[model samples]
Each structure stands twice: as C-alpha cells, then as structure tokens.
Target: MGRINGENRDVVFEELWKLKIPAKSSVFAWRLIKDRLPKKLNLRRGQVVVNGTLCPFCSNNEEEAAHLFFNCSKILPLWWESLSWINIVIELPQNPRDHFLQHGNGNVGGIKSTRWKCW
Candidate 1:
C-alpha cells in the first residue's frame, strides 16, 4: 500500500527532507538506509581490524545496522516500548531500507515522515 513495499530504493537518495534533522543523526540514518554504515560486520568484511563482528550492545550476533537498530535483544524491546508510548507499535523490518521506509511511509514528505527517517 506504500513506499515501504517498493523495491526501487534509489529514491531514498532523493528525500532531502530527512536532512532537516540534526546533521549527525541524519547522516547516521542515511548510512543506515543505504546499508553503508560502518558496522562491525562491514568493517571486518572490508578488511578493517575488528576483534569480532559481534554486536557491542548485545555481545551476540554480527553487528549489522539492522541488528544494531531493530533485532538486538537489548534494543528491540526498547524500541517497541518507546513507540508504544505514542501508540505506534510495529514489527520492525529486518532490512535497513525497509525499516526506514516503514517509518517514512506515513504522510509521505511531511516533517513527521522526515523526522522518523532521521531517527
């Protein structure tokens, strides 16, 4: 029913509205959506020196953006609980782009969608 289900993610690069958030967080979300974040898994794969690919927050599983944000045992419940405060419960997507797109799906280009994308 929305952009969340779309496969053509090149459009993600066009959404400058997300940059309205603080620059650091905006850049982080940008890297995250593009799957370009230097998570431990990516660093190791790129031949960077990392002791392990484990999630630092959980000490379990490889550290990918999806794992860092949504799938970590420590972060997962916190996300669910925080969103519930605003009555926004969701089953977070494992794919990073889809995860951001799910948040951006509502109200399309408005600040609400942009803020979610930047978060």
Candidate 2:
C-alpha cells in the first residue's frame, strides 16, 4: 500500500512553511470561518457570501463589511477610536475569514480588545 498522487485532500495541513500558525489558533480560525450557524443565521451561501450585503455586527441588509467595521453607528466609532490609537487603517475584507484572520494577528491588540468588548 502506497500513497496515491492527485488526491484532493480537503483537510488543512498542520505545517504551511513560514506561515507558522499555532495548531490551536489554526483550528479556532477554521471553526470561526466554517461553522454553519453564522451562515444559517446570516443567510449567506456556502459560508462565502460576498455581495457586500448584510452586516456582520448586525443583520441589516445594506450593511456591508466596510459599514459593519467602519461605518455602522453601533460599531464604527469604537473601531475608529481603536484604529486611531494603533495608528493603522485596515481595509475590511469582504470575506469574514480574511477579516477575522487579519485582525486576529497579535499585532492588532486594539482590534482584539474591541472584540472582547463587544462580547
């Protein structure tokens, strides 16, 4: 018995060479992105909705990622103040995974803090 070539492995590899994501962190990230509850609640398709519709913070139809992260009255000011303190401007990603991954990095302490505050 030997390994076969051209196998479509859907499982994520533990080591990605230079990416160096911790195993727990990688699993948590995947769960955040792949979980079905958010999709069902948000009415997104295949956990990959990108019509720039529906707010991530609130379930409003017109609320895109940008609005949710930087324009919505409920979350905008808090995020703005946090970014101002850090002196960085992150362009919100259309995909929830990208947005979460980018901010999940240790450098974005403010973002992490804000997430906690929200929860």
Candidate 3:
C-alpha cells in the first residue's frame, strides 16, 4: 500500500511488498509496520471496549505494538535468540518497521539475504 494521502510510496512499504513471503504474512507485516494491528491500546483508541490495556504476557504496561514485540520482557528474549541463530548480534531497533527493515537489509547477498529477511 502506498501513502493513504496519495503521497509517494514509503520505501519501507515498497521493500515490504517485494519480500518473498506469503500474502497473509506480508499483510501482517504491513499492519505491523503501520502500527495498525488491533493490539489492546489500538483497540481502545478505536472505541472498542477492552477489559485491560496491559500486555497479556507481562501486564506491566499498556499493550502496544512496540511493547508487545520489542520491549516486553517475555518476548524480547525470543527476538534475541532468533537473531543469534542467524549470527546477528546487533541491538534491536525499538520500532517494528525499523526492526523489519534492519533484518531485511542484512549484509548478505541474494538468496541468503532474502532468507534472512524471511527468517
């Protein structure tokens, strides 16, 4: 998807669509990059009643995309382990789009790069 207001397409989105992933996975990434997932905070903002906004895993703060995927104590380790398996040792970006872009743009080449991006 391009800009909602008819501006130039975002590079992140352009790169996102080129990934050799399933359509559903690509759509999920698009929603994640746009911060449009129906996480608790987003649901509340959309006027959908939520019992509690706290993250289901940690319950330490309002459930938002950033916290759920990046900052959550329970989930962050999984990210680390996944990265480590691929020999990546860099600090993770806090924003989901940044994280995706970083992982998708690894220094490897061709199939390896695509595989890392997919991974």
TM-score for predicted model 1 compared with the true structure = 0.76
Cα lDDT listed for each candidate:
0.76, 0.50, 0.82
TM-score, prediction 3? 0.87
- For every model shown, the clashing-pair count is 0, 0, 0
Tell me the TM-score of each prediction against the true structure. Answer: 0.76, 0.37, 0.87
Best by lDDT: 3
Runs with alpha carbons beyond 4 Å of true place in candidate 1: 1-9, 16-19, 109-112
Query: How many angstroms is residue 58 displaced in model 3 relative to the true structure, after the best TM-score fit?
Result: 0.6
Report the lDDT tens digits of candidate 2 across residue range 1-119: 13345365332221211134566655555554454234333545557645565565676646544454445667867867777876667665555445555554554446453352222
Q: All predictions: root-mean-square deviation over Cα?
A: 5.7, 8.7, 2.7
> Residue 85 of model 3: what lDDT?
81
lDDT score, candidate 1 = 0.76
User: Where does candidate 2 stray beyond 4 Å?
Assistant: 1-29, 38-59, 62-73, 103-119
